[model samples]
Target: MEFDYVIIGAGSAGCVLANRLSADPSLNVGLIEFGGSDQSIFIKMPTALSIPMNMDRFNWGFESVEEPGLNGRRMDCPRGKVLGGSSSINGMVYVRGHACDFEEWREAGASGWGYADVLPYFKKAESWMSGEDTYRGGSGPVKVNNGNNMKLNPLYEAFIKAGNEAGYPITGDYNGFQQEGFGPMHMTVDGGVRASTAKAYLDPVKHRTNLTIMTDMMAEKVILENGVARGIELTSKDGKSETIKVRKEVILAAGSIGSPTLLQRSGVGDAASLSAAGVEPVLDLPGVGQNLQDHLEVYFQYKCKEPLTLNSRLGLVSKGMIGTQWMLFKSGLGATNHFESCGFIRSRKGLKWPDVQYHFLPAAMRYDGRAAFEGHGYQVHVGPNKPSSRGSVSITSPKAAQKPRIQFNYLTTDQDVEDWRNVIRLTREILNQPALDRYRGDEIQPGLSITSDEQIDQWVRENVESAYHPSCTCKMGDRDDTLAVVDSNCSVRGLQNLRVVDSSIFPTIPNGNLNAPTIMVAEKAADHILGKGLLSPIDAPYWIDEDWENRQRPREPKNAMM
Candidate 1:
């Protein structure tokens, strides 16, 4: 088969590219996925998110190779294998990342990717439920809203109010004007159904004659001719292999892990490593899989004094009611992911932007919805967003079937370790504030006894888990940077007609969930891929603590009790 554009991996990025590229009838666009359709109810239902996230049929099932920083433990690395990719299986939380994060991208040689340059794309990718503003998008493919507006449970209210009681700023919307504050969180959901890329971008345009979607077909490698990507070889579910010619460009949207490994398998990564993996070297790029980064979070659980948390409704009958309500009226507790309130704050005084992030959950249970506490309780998931530690993802052998070796080296740096210590202490302070006086009981995960610096470090090392935000494997930079695999336009270095449009091209992981930003990247890249004039930069105002250099947190409560 031949097409003008062959986009690999029908995930968040590829789905948008497929919809945008195929809009012109003159161009033929093909999208391929290793996993089947995302038609399962678990994928469509917002609250049943944990099911598809851990299910083998929808997950890629990648794990770290006994990370040295996690005390020789292998962390679960869940990347999406299904049609919508991780967006279909994630918690549905929507975060655009702090604008300052894009400034950092510009500093790292990603020219034209500063906050001002990319704000237009971020605004274009979503149709926010709150309606159109200077910053938020409207009439877009993806539907987003403040899930349930934290009204179903009072615990969400307590968490945000508690942050203010503990002397923290409270912004109305984190994705909007300011990010360094506590406020309501947005989710990619509307009318009780998830707004994954496949559902939003692909479903409405599937009948287009120029577009083709092939599932259950794994991409083997990019076919290159004298250093130029000419086609891509894919293997079917039944083990039949074939090469599809690329008449225009071969776009790699296989995500951080798959994209880097495919480049290595195509002999485009570090020459020495590719040769060692039994692959002939086609190029000497050494940065295909380097600069790995992710967020590590530890859940801070608290036993509730009242029967007010989600735990009270964990019985079989209650779950049945929730499912039935969603199935029938598309309302009730199943309509949202229940991650209503969140906070973003800096760990230390001198940092201009928030380095730590928090997610307030109404139920104190494992991520898989397995009950951990016997009765009513809640938990705050906290972590350092801008971790300094780096690692790599490299192929073990020249085979597409083999999972690549991943090592995040989490907490390997002293800065990362110091940040976690602050993360636990700050979250504990927020949960202990007077707003939670009526509901707070005993500390659960890192108990009240775990107070010392030594105790905090030990507890964090034992309990910290991946936030599922892996990125920066094929980072973008200028052509002069040796570690850069892609240039400003996401075009591969030393190659022609090849580009990687995904989170993998991110120069650094941002200060929030990667879904919104990943979609924004693809939206922006679509213009470049079509040779259209880029979106005009929007210089919108953003906020940071004015006295940040002198104070780590607010000296006194900003808002009095209402």
Candidate 2:
């Protein structure tokens, strides 16, 4: 089949491109997804997020190569294989990262990617429940709702209150003027269902006759001809191999891991690595899979003194009741991911922005809800948002089915170690506040006995897990950058009629979850793809404590104690 644009992977970015590119009925767009339809009940039910993330049918259960930094442990890296990609299976939290993060991107040779240049796209993609403002978007495709209403769980209140007691200012919205503080988390959930890119962008336009979505079709390689991308060779679910030609351009939205692997398979990566993997090199792009980055977090579990935690509600009867409520009325415990309250904070006094993030849950368990403690308990998933360590994603073989070799090389730097130590120290202080005196219990994961820096370092090495925010495998930057794969326009640096619009194009990892930022990237790229002029940069002011240079806490509030 021939189309104006052939997008690989009907994930977050591809879905957005499909909807936007097909807006002109005269243009044809084809979207390919390796996984099946996202029609399962488990995907729609917000609380059942674990079901899709842990099941191989919905997730590409890719494990990393043993990391030397984490005591030689192999970490599990799950990416969504379904229609919406990782957006369909990720924790529903919606975060745009610190504004300065985008500024850093601009400073790192990613022109037109500063905070001012990107905010307009971020605003354009969100329909925030709280209404429009200079900082928040109100009339957009994705539905963003604050899920941390105190009425949902008392622990949320305690978590925020504890932050205040710990001398941190309370910002009602972290994705607003100020990102560094405790606040209600925004979720991509509307009416108790996941608002994946497919639901927000694709579903609304799926009926457009100009757009075609092919699920269960795995892209084997890009059809490159004389330094230009022309089509894609893919394997159908029924074992049929075919080539779909693109009349205009081919966009690779296969995510951080999938995108780079596809490029290498298509002979567009580092020549040395390609030769070793038995693939003839078409273009020697050394950065195709370099600069791999991700967030690693460890759960800080604590037994709860009260029966208010979700553990009490996990019984079979309770599950049935919650499921019934959600199935019938789209309300109840099943309506939320229970990651209601969260925060972002700097690890130390001199940092420019929040380097650490917190996701407070009312239950003490792993992300997949396994290994529950015997009684009521709670936990906080905390980690450094930006790690200095860098890694790579490389093709191990020429075959399309073979997974790429992912090595995050996590915790290899001294700054990473220091940041992790700070997370634990600060988290312990917050949990010990008088605000949580009523609910705080004995520490569970890294108990109080683990106090020394050496002990904390060991605990982190043994327990840290990927925050599932892998990105930057094919970073965007100035053409002069030796390792840049794509330019600021999202086009491949050395190839024509080819571009990458996904998390993989990030110049660096943002300070929060990747879904919101990935969507913003696609929104921005759509304008570029259609030859539309860039949005006027919005110079919105973000929060910065005047005393930030001198103290950890803001100085204006004289009575505030640090």
Candidate 3:
């Protein structure tokens, strides 16, 4: 098969590219997905998110090669191998990192990607339920709505109030003008169903005559000739191999781990390493998979004095009822991801933006859909958003099917350690606030006993888990940088007609969940690929603590005008 534009890995970015590029009718777009359709009810229903994330049928189930920083633990890295990619199995919380995150991107050589340069694309992709304003889109492909747009659960409101009581600024919407402070978090959900890229961008455009989607087809390697990526060698699920030609460009949307490994297997990486791995080196680029990053988190738990948490609803009968209600009406407890409340805060004073993020869930549980406590309890999922530690993704062989080695040297820096300590300390302060006084019980994790820098450090090493936001392997950077993989336009530094889109091209991991920003990247990239001029940047205002130089947090809570 031959197409003008071929996009590998129909994840968040690939789906968007397929829709946009194929719109011209003159452009034939082929989107290749390693996994099959995302039609399972487990994926369709937002509450069943955990099932798909852990299932091998939907997730890549890639595990890291023992992290040295985590006491030699090999963390589970769940990348979606299905139609929507990770978005199908993700927590569905929509967050675009702090505005300043893009500034750092520009600083790292991803020019024209500053907050002002990229914010328009973010608005272009979002069809927010709350309607359009200066910062959000109202009628875009991806449907986004405030988590629990209605105040169905008091816990959601309580968490936001608690953040205020703990002296954090309370914004109406974090994804709006202000990214800092406590606010209502969003989910890519519409009509009680997931708004994954497949559903949002691909579903509506699937019938386009110029677009072809191939599922259960593995991309073996990019077929390069004269230093130009011409096409790709693909393997069918039944082991049949075929070559598909690309006339214009071959886009790699295989995500952070997959993209870098694909580049390596295709002989586009470190000359010495590729030669050692039995692959002829096409380029001497040493930065193919070097700058890996992810957010590491721990659930700060507290036993609830009252049975207000989701733990009480984990029983089979309760679950059955929730499922029945959702199946019949698409409403009820099952419709929500239950991460309605959240916050972003600076770990220390004088920081230009938030370095920590909080996802307040009503149940004290692990991300694996397992309860940590047998009774009613709640937990605040807190993590350092801006990590300094770096790791890598590299190929040990030339085989396309072989999973690449991934190591996200998490918590290796002193800054990381300090960030963890501050998030934990602040979480304790928030949980102790009068807003939670009636419901809060004993601290269940890191306990009240796990105080001090040494104790907190040890506890974090033993308990912290990956937030599953792996990114920055084929990071975009300045052309002169030897370690830079892609340039600002996402074009590989030493190659032609090849580009890497997705979080893999991120120069730095953003402050919160990656789904929102990844989609934004694809939306922006689609325009780039189409030769369309960028949407005009909106110089919107955002919140920054005016007293940050003198205080880490407000000394008193300000009453929000209702």
The C-alpha TM-scores of every prediction are 0.98, 0.98, 0.98
Q: How close is each model in CA RMSD to the real structure?
A: 1.8, 1.8, 2.4
lDDT of each: 0.92, 0.90, 0.88
Q: Which ten residues in a row have the lowest lDDT in candidate 3?
A: 553-562
- Candidate 3 lDDT over 237-316, as tens digits, reads 89999999999999999999899999998998888989988999988889899989999999999999887788988889
TM-score of 3: 0.98
**What digit string (tens of lDDT, one per residue) describes model 1 on residues 71-150?**
88899999999999999999999999999999999999999999999989988999988788988988788899878899
Off by over 4 Å in 3: 556-562
Sort the candidates on lDDT, descending order: 1, 2, 3
Model 2: what TM-score?
Answer: 0.98
Model 2 C-alpha lDDT per residue in residues 128-219, reported as the tens digit of each score: 99889998899999999965355778899889888887878899888989999998888999878889988999899989999999999989
Top of the candidates by lDDT: 1
